[model samples]
Target: MKIFNTQTKRKEEFVPLEGKRVKMYVCGPTVYGDAHLGHARAAVAFDLIRRFLEHEGFHVSFVQNFTDVDDKIINKATEEKTSIGEVARRYALSYLQDMVALHVRRADFYPLATETLPVMQDVIQKLIAKGHAYVGDRGDVYFDTESFPAYGKLSKRPKQEMESLGAQDKGLSEKKNLKDFALWKTRETKNEVGWDSPWGYGRPGWHIECSAMNLHYLGESIDIHGGGQDLIFPHHENEVAQCEALTGKPFAKYWLHNGFVNINHAKMSKSLGNFFTIRELLKQFTGDQLRLFLLTSQYRKPIEFSLDILREKLPLNQRIEAALEYLERNLQVAGLTPTLLYNEAYRGDYGFAATSTTDETEATAEENTRKSLVASREKFLQALRDDLNTPMALAELMNLVKIIQAWNKPPEVKSPSPSIVTIKFTFIILREILDIFGLYPRDSGNLHPAVTHLEKFIDAKLQERTQARKKKDFKKSDAIREELNKIGVEIQDFPNKSTWNWRK
Candidate 1:
């Protein structure tokens, strides 16, 4: 397997430090605010990576960290007149809820920065002994970027260019280099939250916490390290520098970056004054819809998330979902052999031809067109291998679903040999792939939440109208419909049955 490593700016074979075992460390959310759409993209991107790796039969251990201690947490805590841990804990819990709702698998470890201070200090001590960092007069410690010649390699920026950019010295001793970053700041009342350290009482820097957690949890080298592209510059780069400088080993074998879910061609950031939290957005749309929309584009490309597209794209998904559900329902009703797993042998390689034949003899070749199944399956796998090319994989999956629809539908067709092993092979493969992509299993196998609530309200309205009609009031039925219409629900009358779709 190969992945595009940001450090090399090219695709490289993915060989884990341990044979057949993949370890991934994702830079997790800061936990100061509700996770936004950008956060959603990163999470989904890495989630796909883990899913695909597991699909390919590799054991994966994924760990993501929580930055419980930060300026934002402190400020939010102060504003709410609560403890900092309370603020962090509330938001962290919310993030976990949101992640679970989105079907994101729980990581092997989710460490908090505050919980790993001792490990962080140990790493800091190594840097100090190596002369890569030093204690300042004010008792703060700073990483001397000049000490690491490869400091800016990951970001492809020159030291001269960085200095020319006029970055702040950030309140360190005069003896410290201007470009040096703080490892710890001297304890002071002004710095709301401080932890006791060798130099003084201070918390971990944003970048250091991840390195410490990554090394402690996954060790010096791992299979993959992923996060939003925004962290490429100082955060990931510094993590590379600090971890490698201490351990004398590559921090991560493959560095994966998820492109931004851009707004107006600009990266979404708090400083940019344009941030959309995923938790809040999920309130408006289902998690499946959000995951599908995010996966509609390749993970490496930027996504222009717009309201109109979201509206348009969702129903398209609904249509495909509706079609797949139709197949699943009919398949179950037909009582086809309930097999343990789908088997894929003797299936056609791929394409529409695999599922079609104009000649009677060819049609009676005793097959479900092995070629078509192979083609579709190959395309799906290729897309997955190509940096988890979800959109392409999605297109192929939908196409396969259509083919299945065409074959399994009305026209009395010749059934293939029931004993053919490949017949079930194709079926199981598609189902398995779809499951990993989070596009299968249809509605909750019950009424949707929106539908359930709408039904309850409609039932009440119908009872009210039934009473009104008993009193010979035609106006009341029409009035009830109007009331439902105002709240985004619609009713359609049928000869024997009634149903509803969302109202505009």
Candidate 2:
């Protein structure tokens, strides 16, 4: 597998330091508000990477950190007249809930800044001992940018250029250089939350929190370190300096950063009044549809999010679900037992070796269909391996869907249908690929109670309309159809049955 390394500015082959064991660290949110579309994008982007690696037979240990104590969290606590812990707890839970809703797997270790204070302090002391950091006049510790010769290597900015960015915090006058960033910030107000450290009562700076947690959890070096593209500068740059200065080893083998999510061609931000929370979006789009929409673009490419794009995804998601459902229902009607040919235990294998069939021999048409399915599977995996080109992979999946749809259609008169083994194997491959993308069939078993009730209500109305048609009462049937349409329901009539779906 090849990944674009931000530090090298090129795509390179991925080779874990420990063979077949990958250690990855992604920056998590600072729990001050609800998780938004940006957060969802970041989560899903890394989740795809992790899932793909695992599917390739790698043992991945993923770690993400929560900045539970920050200026934002403290300010939110003061504004809401609540404790810092309460504000952090509420939003942290909200972020996790959003991740679950988006089908993002939980990190193996979710260390919090508050819990890693000792670790952060130890890193600061090491930097100070190495003359890479110094204590400021007001008891705050600032990293001495000049002491580290490769300070701007990761960001690729000259020291003078970086100094012009300026500091927003007050300890700038105390720092030896303007480019220097705080390792431990001194609290100005007694009411704010803080912890006792050598640099007085204060909290860890945003950059140091990640560096400390990653070093403590994943050792001195990691396989991959990732976050949004915005963090490439000061944030990740400082992290690299801090870790390498202390351990004198490469911080990470590969640096991956996902692109931003824009709204109306502008960066999504609260200041723009165009920011959207994940919860707000969930009300309109199902989790699977949202996931598919996000994966429609390459991970490193910026995506312009809009309602129209989401609406387009809804029908695509519906088609995939319908195809899978049809495959299952048709297999049952044909009196053929549908077997799951793919198993988790054989994920490392390639081609038909990953799937098994009871019938070894097949007819000419069935063999042709099987070859097509195998080629599609290979194309899908190749796309993912090429730096996580999800758009290409998704196109392959859609192609498979088209092939299945064509195969499921009734054969010509006197023509023999494909073998049951071929049909079952194709279903297995489709489901396995979809599972990697976190798309699952929405069935009654997992439907929300309110939705189930709504579906039952709609079914009853359709049944009533059917009864009206059976009685030859055309007026009653027309009245029932009009009433249903008035409430945003569209019913389709067939010779023997009727179906209803919601109309936007």
Candidate 3:
């Protein structure tokens, strides 16, 4: 598989450091407020990479940390007149809830900054002892930028440029070097949120939390380290310096960063005042709908957001959902068992579980369908393998849906052949691919409450309309049709019967 490494600025082959075991660490939310689209985008992007890794037969130990101790969290606590722990726990739980709603798998470890204090302090001690960091005059410990000759390598910015920028900012005036960043920020009193360290009472700096967590959880070196592109500069670069400085090894084999989410031609951020909370969008759209819309663009490119575009993508998601329901319902009616595996259970190449005769020997229709199914699955995997090109992968999924819809088009045939069973199982394999994408339909059967209710109402109305037509009450029949139309229902008439579906 290939992944675009932000540090190298190129697509590179992914080979885990420890055989087939992959250790992936992603920067998670700060947990000061509710998660927005920006958070969801990064979460979904890395989740896709994690899922793909698992699908490729890798044991992925993914850790996404929560920055439970931050200036924002502290400020929020002061504003709410509550403890920092309360504030952190509130938003952290909110973030986990949003992840669940979005179908993002929970990370193997969700270490909090407050809980990882010991490790953070230990890392800082090593840096200070090795002369890579020093205590500032004000009691804060700042990293010694001059000590690490490769300080700017990951960010590709010259020390001169960083020095120039730091000169303008009043915050760096106290540090020995302009590029020096805090390893620990001292608190004035014991009442504040801090721990007793060798350098006095202070909290871990923003970047140090990740470095400490990565070291404690995944060891000194890991396969992949990922976050949003915004963190590429000081955040990730500093992590590289601290981690490699302490362990004298590569921090991570590959660095991955996802692109931003734009709103009104500007990046959507919590500080920007143009962000939409994931909770707000969930009111009108399902988690899968939101997820599908986010994946419409490639992970490394920004996606423009608007309700119109989101609604337009609704049918694409619905098409996939409708196909699954149609195939499952039809197969069950034909007394055929639809065997499928969950996303985690899928080990790749399990899609062809149902044996079939030679394609040339099968009927022409079945032969063509089987070829399309096999081709679509291959295309889907190929797209994902190519740097996780989700748009291309989604197109392949749509093609699978089209093939299923075409084969099952009706005048409902009930004489289930072995070919049909093979096609159904193949479709289930395609569904496994969707699961890897984290797009699972809520109802794969005919038991969706809203859908079942609508069916009963529509069926009753259709019956009433039929009686009206038989009684020569043409006006009443027309009125009934108009009523259904107002409710976004359309009916297609046939010689023996009629069928109904939501109007496009």
In candidate 2, what are the lDDT values of residues 286-319, reduced to their tens digit? 6677788899989999999998877977777877
lDDT score of model 1? 0.75
Residue 53 error for model 1, in Å?
Answer: 1.2
Q: Give the per-residue Cα lDDT of candidate 2 at 146.
A: 89
Model 2 clash number = 0
User: Lowest-scoring 10 consecutive residues by lDDT in candidate 3?
Assistant: 443-452
lDDT of each: 0.75, 0.82, 0.83
Estimate the Cα RMSD of every predicted model relative to the unseen true structure: 9.6, 11.1, 13.0
How does model 1 score by TM-score? Answer: 0.80
Instruction: Tell me the RMSD of model 2 versus the true structure.
Output: 11.1
Evaluated at residue 165, the lDDT of candidate 2 is 72
Alpha-carbon TM-score of each model against the true structure:
0.80, 0.83, 0.83
lDDT of 1 by residue, 307-329 (tens): 67777778756756655555445
Off by over 4 Å in 3: 164-173, 337-361, 412-418, 443-504
